[model samples]
Target: METHDSLLARIAPAPGQCSRTILDPATGTPVGEAPVHTVEDLEAAVAAAAAAQPAWAALGHDARSAALLKAADAVERSAEELARLLSREQGKPLNGPNARFEVGACAAWLRATATTPLDPETVVDDGETRAELHYRPIGVVGAIGPWNWPMMITTWQIAPALRMGNTVVVKPSEYTPLSVLALTAVINEELPEGLLTVISGGPDVGEALASHPAIGKVMFTGSTATGKAIIRSSADTVKRLTLELGGNDAGIVLPDADPKAIAQDLFWGAFINTGQTCAALKRLYVHDSLYDAVCEELAAVAAAMPMGNGLDENNVLGPLQNQQQYDILARLVDAARDAGARILLGGNPDPGQPGNFYPTTLVADIDNNNPLVTEEQFGPALPIIRYTTIDQAIAMANALDVGLGASVWSPDVSAAREVAARLQAGTVWINKHGAVDPRIPFGGAKQSGYGLEFGTEGLKALGQPQIINGWTATQTRATPN
Candidate 1:
């Protein structure tokens, strides 16, 4: 098998002293050379997509659905190799929770999107007059995906866009571009050339894709700051956008909840993907009656989970995917400690550690005002805040600039759902957290970002709405300028 480095070098720009090396976060070893693309590269890709989208869309829904399903099959066939590459590049453990699952999710999403129907609806019918609403493809879609869950999130953007008949030009994160490139190769076998192009680079490439005049829609999944930048860049073109940005999600533990039963679920909810998830539970607000018990239970679970390199089968949690995130998390933990929050578990990074590994940390008695609780610490550290009343907990949770996801934990399903309805988030869970489905729409509210990502609403977001109206000969028609 050709090495990842060699595979990437074939498509990369001419070898230069300035070429950026993609480091394997697990070992800090150079795994691939990411292409440094210019505005020309982005323009060429967008132009190709602009030319290809009409024919692809003209093939109609059935043909497009068949191609997507075939692409899904190709992805499944190469799942193992892709999963291995993903673990090496993204620092997600291959066997345990999410690395393999992420790769498999790409295939699953493609299949689901391939079959999700988008039939024309008869909006009005009054015997003599009738009207129908149609969903038509919106030219080329520019997809800028994040590094965490690289392949799955990329598919989350492209699959629906393609299913809705829009050709795509994707720019994956430079840190983990190879897996997306590899997955694109598999997909291209079933898709038409230029229908799904992968261009890898830093901000320059992303900026070009977002602002390109040929691109009709931009689908982005990243930090709120970057999402805002894309919105501004695309503003001149008045491009359609579907932005899935950051989230500092809060998970509340009601006084009636059982800490022991919910401990394992809560721990994984916050720490999945090594707590590098944008929608992971960053803050936990527990009722004072159950706060201490919840803290101890959560601490015990965190202590038991193994954290190490992604290749190790025994390790469920891997290192932070990059140094920047590691530093941010470390600073947040330090601030929490200085603010008088009690550290119930791991709080420091091991200087001797080979990778960017911050231990699974739990800080208790922190207030909502603490930076650790307020900011989206996309790492392994979680702050546990104490709340005296349910209203206080809900208020504290909703105080942040972000409102992506929130959850309520209680034994009474009815009571839990009542509180869930009050939480200001795109998706509120009764017991679980961050369990999103393709059949349901998922997007952020407020500064978190806008536009849904899945389901009928999301599918339609990628297309333009066209309405056809007809009247009987009995109705008089007037010509208007």
Candidate 2:
């Protein structure tokens, strides 16, 4: 594998920071490099953003909308190259970025942001006094993203901030910087320099950006451990926060469902990107009556799928992103097996292929005490815990602190809807898994993090609503226009 640092020379530049080489996750190769910002760099980026913000916001509806439409066009033009870079950096499998799902969604989102308004409207009216509400941009946003779903996550942060008329300075995880850098370049051609910036590096940079004075809001998506750190740093300014943290999401299979059908849904839910997704179904509770059948079908599917680097379109699973994830997966598998959980399919890393990746793992009879059942595994391992009733299943599923996403499997749409409604997750699917639409609001509840990130609610999350308690045409709107 070529040294990942090799790509440092040609990738792209951060608006006000130094750049670094970003490595490829597939083979530890360097596909390219990106700017790596420092505390000073973060501050500089924020300053630039603050200086440029008012003008961008002043551009208002039409001008901003036109620019964003240009961004959508750029995304469409570079879709293929972007997908290849996304797969190499993020370790998603065959369908990976090729799904074109997030790409198209972003184009639609950016355009939507361009047109949405935050102006004051008359709510209650009388002769001389009137009351109204006004929505305004919050200012410069410091957006920190995770390793999974780089392009989509970037849009989640940027579109809202831009749409609401605030500028953004983003920090992509150290693991997958190239993809973010590639994405920023596409946006750069459409907007001014400081409007959307990307910065890469580790802890120092993240803390630096989060706490910077010029940043008005800090939005983050990553592990719970790091999220705490970021929160602590942002305290000085009390910067507004939006966090989409880790999820040990659960999938419940009702007794009335067909095992084969549920098994298929759970496969993509659990093993997509080799299960590196934040909200990917990590813990599963199958109805006791269908336990054995569900296990059999899931194992057969896992064993049948091809695993390799994502460069080939035929591969269903790709290499894990790095050594740390590899070690974590191995430990989880071993621990589950030791706890007497039945390993029906892939349980360990493939030694024949020397890379940072694992196969789809399905374990049965895993107890709640097991961390694999309680914690967010964030890997390809799926521990199927059996339950007897809907109440028991729901109880077990809601038992974890991370409530990012969940799915209720049943051919019965009515039953699925009922179970899904009761789930304490940000997003829930019925009879289907890992299926997301651009129009639906996405994000998690509780420890998984607060704040919504898509659709209309998501667009609204980026806005500030001001109550016009006492108003005249001129005595009102003390707030800046």
Candidate 3:
């Protein structure tokens, strides 16, 4: 029930603190001021987290789970305010799979992370010896989040770390700090002081957070370049890392797929969040037999989705989050046009537009090696490549150094599974793309990044594993000569 101004005021920086004005991506207007914390601030946060860790871990699993449940309720109570703030700051509309969906996902992941069990397991149990494996708290964890889904990704990083009994210090992206600050404020209502904190600073602060000696682990979701930088910084400390980096995911369409039947799903797969998703389908490969038909169907679906300011309820799609991203998308689309690729729809934008609004573009008859197809556009431009054989499609798909996700679309489930098996991605969807689940483990292969998040595997990643081995009292030990 909080009003927009009241919610913004709650997360505003203190009167004298150094801060930066966050701009609305849909319109070049100030959303709110995010406090610019420095390396000193990061040190204090980490110190506090390190100091608070042992007591939190001693509370045991049930108490922590109960606290997380209350935090989830807190998120629900402030859901509307968080969604509206996210829409303004991140440039995703309130409708569709944008702001509201991201906020709802935050609460869902909290509840899921709270209840998922990780009981001690007896790895080896013979009559003579028994060995059990258990996970212990890693103390302090540092979380670095990206801008595209700021609030939800923050939840993804923090929930498991807290559930595993580690205190977390978050460093949100410079582009979307207000959303994260507001979100953590809501969740912190039910959490103890110093249990969770957000440091909204520049790259220097991020570097400090990753390399700080007090932090035992770091969970990051950002570019491959930043992920590599984090690895180098953490080398001295040998911090445990969970990195979800950049991905130029691909999707393959079999000749048997019905173009009209799957067009809607295909459109959303590539254009979700204006195509800012890390695991979104960027390059699509369709069999030559149905290439033209698939392109036409997808183009028809893309042309109908409304794009405007995020405050507008009817506009499901919004502007690119920043001008740099908009320029990257425009340059790639223009290069495709110069290469004589067929533009099925939307390759141009009005220069007079107020915000960074690039049109939804679909390029067909494009070569597999074209930059738009080869590189990660990270926008609402999809390059469709045609292939005569499944092997050729699979080869192009696997050729990329980064493989986070991919999909195979076919009417026959069995056939789709066969094609999917040949893909080198971390997750291969049979008839869809980027349908991440809280219960299923998600990560990347190759240069896309390392480690896993979500489910039981995710919980284990946040903690340190220990083995307890002992001999049974009934067993008699033999003497060695």
Model 1 lDDT tens row, 134-171 = 99999999999998989999999999999888999999
Screening candidate 3 with a backbone cut-off below 3 angstroms (N, C-alpha, C), the clashing residue pairs are none
Candidates sorted on lDDT, descending: 3, 1, 2
Clashes counted in candidate 2 amount to 2
Ranking by TM-score: 3, 1, 2
TM-score of 1: 0.96
Model 2: per-residue lDDT, tens digit, 115-174?
554456788887557788776788899899887777788887898788778899989888
TM-score of 3: 0.99
Q: Which residue runs does candidate 1 get wrong by more than 4 Å?
A: 1-18, 478-481
**Which 10-residue span in candidate 3 carries the lowest summed lDDT?**
1-10
Question: Candidate 3 overall Cα lDDT vs. reference?
Answer: 0.94
> Residue 62 in model 1: shift from native, Å?
0.7
Which residue pairs clash in candidate 2? Answer: 19-35, 320-357
Give the whole-model CA lDDT for all candidates, comma-separated.
0.88, 0.78, 0.94
Candidate 3, 435-459: lDDT as tens digits: 9999999999999999999999999
Candidate 2 vs candidate 3, lDDT winner: 3
Pick by lDDT: which candidate is best?
Answer: 3
